[model samples]
Target: MKNASPRWFTSSYSENGGVCVEVATNLAASHGTVPVRDSKTPTGPSLAVSAEAWTTFVAMTRH
Candidate 1:
């Protein structure tokens, strides 16, 4: 895959103060990974999780 930039975005439901994480799902198709970082620190280190794992995690949280 090419070097794709991560387009970070926070959830609309995360309105409870400034404690939230940002996710870059835009690279899931091209990179097969989802980069996640803290909303408080945009320049901080991010965690790269597998696309499949991220999907499962989100599905579990919805239950």
Candidate 2:
């Protein structure tokens, strides 16, 4: 999967010296998958979930 440079975005709530979570909304253009990764390891593997699953995860974690 060359050229698979997923752009990542950190959480607005993140405000520390360092964090490792990044969400790639670029995959949302497909309206099917959402990409999640660890910024600490850019070369690390990524997980792609359905948009609905991603939304649910976010909502549940908000509490």
Predicted structure with the largest lDDT when compared to the true one: 1
Candidate 2 residues 3-50, lDDT tens each? 454678888888765775888877665556788887787778888888
Candidate 1 residue spans exceeding 4 A from truth: none
For each candidate in turn, the TM-score is: 0.92, 0.73
lDDT of each: 0.95, 0.78
Best by TM-score: 1
Residue 45 of model 1: what lDDT? 98
For residue 27, give model 2's deviation from the true position in Å: 1.5
The TM-score of candidate 1 is 0.92
For model 1, how does the per-residue alpha-carbon lDDT over 2-59 read when each residue is reduced to its tens digit?
8889999999889968899999999999999999999999999999999999999999
Minimum summed lDDT over a 10-residue window in model 2 is located at 1-10
Clashing pairs in 1: none
**How far is each candidate from the true structure, as Cα RMSD in Å?**
1.1, 3.4
